[model samples]
Target: MINYISDHLKNNPLLVLDGAMATELEKHDIDTDSELWSAIALINNPEAIKEVHESYFKAGAKVATTNTYQANVEKFQQFGLNEAEAKKLIIKAVQLAQAAKAEFKADDLLVAGSIGPYGAYLADGSEYRGDYDLTITEFMDFHRQRMQLLNQANVDLFAFETQPNFEETKALAKLLKTEFPQKTAWMSFSIKDSQTLCDGTPLNEAVKYFNDDQQIAAIGVNCTKLENIEDTIVNIKKVTNKPIVVYPNNGDIYDPKTKTWQANPKTSSFKELVPKWIDAGASLIGGCCRTTPADIKEIAEFT
Candidate 1:
């Protein structure tokens, strides 16, 4: 299988991923406060999703991540989409992103299909806690249908991101190897700190688990605090030689109960930290929650 990220990485040392999708969607006044999250826009307002992709491209992003992060077959069916309808919606996400890239005329740009953890479907923030338990087969069962859809939809690669469970991460990598041999993905975990995954798995241990997987093009963390990213990169490099992918949140504290964000005074400016992250060996850099295209522009400029 051709590693799509390498095509972009060949010319540049780092692949600049786009900023948040749900974050950008919220700015469009789209109500993302639902179980479906950004997938709701795929059902009601797909054009807005496309425009967000274009905005990131305009902001100097080299990749557009499809708005399928929180989308899944069961959730879509629960929200009134038939299985076929849900599948179509997933395919539509890839189309919308591909359309944006084509319109941007950078043919060099790429589209990564977003695959969030099962915890995202639970909608209780377990993705950041990794407390949920599922056997590897169960994890594969829940994720296989969607991965099959994204594979057939022709995504350049899958973005298995914000993964918290080490077992679940194993499931994704195994599924990619046995089922989708033609595809490759980047696996990113949610962390409790620089050295540990949200589930308390040591970052180095989880990272070393798949250090030999050729299908996993990159490995690192996402949706983590800015304060942890620099150290997180150092930790990941200690385990593997794969490309390191890091995209941290804006560092604002989120009160999930109230669905609000409070400023974190100690958080340094995103621009101020870009060089440090790059120097720490982050080959794939971008923004996560609360980050904007402007932040992505900072990374693009610095790289």
Candidate 2:
């Protein structure tokens, strides 16, 4: 019921979001190479997940995105977990973040329940491609269960992140607007470039689609290239007065064939980029893949 993000923004210049979950988990020695990605840690290394959350909080992040990006009942069942067991793991991801908040004793901390796109469950890099097709009902059916679970878990808010498919984004907005009216979310896309979503929807059109929806707390981009953010933020700000939330990858190039992220020395650090994003009107900022708590600390310092 509390708008943790907007409330923070009212008193503070910007809200600081936590960095990567799966990659951050690796630093604690948790294997995240599985199809489940960071969600695997919920079942295998929950303690480490909690530690990562605490690390982000200690590093100055006011928001912790739960380790549920790839966690869904169907995906967990593939590992032989029953429906109830799978659901428990989903909730456990939330509990670990809450436990971390409690351990840190931060009254202002917020836990955002992460809901990745359907492609995330495919684990086929389809999320970046946005080439999947599903009817509205089918899309809602696939996402509803997890949203319901997260809602029941009482997360501070939902983070509909890295969403690519426009139809899927429409479906999620409809689901939230119709069913979870009391809940608030920030919908961030996986953009293809400065002017288009991964699915090829024009950035202005897609951003304008949800511009009037109060249930959507903010709208912008995430899990994208850092170089892609400033222009993308400028584009979104043009169509919507809603706050813009952006957390880009570490400016490393990802290779689909090798599924590895390569560091590019040409990439500018967050210190150089954060000021531009802030100037461009980004209200909440953080890091995505390959970015660590230090990046978040840099963002916090500059903000």
What would the per-residue lDDT of candidate 1 be over residues 83-183, giving only the tens digit for each residue?
A: 99999999999999999999977777899989999888899988889999999999999999988998888999999999999999999999999999989
- lDDT of candidate 1 at residue 56, scale 0 to 100: 95
Question: Candidate 1: where is the Cα deviation over 4 Å?
Answer: none
For each candidate, give its TM-score against the true structure.
0.97, 0.98
lDDT values for all models: 0.91, 0.90
Q: Give a tens-digit lDDT track for model 2, residues 87-199.
A: 99988889889999998786889999998999999999989989999999999999999999998888989999999999999999999988898899999998889899889
Using alpha carbons, what is the TM-score of model 1?
0.97
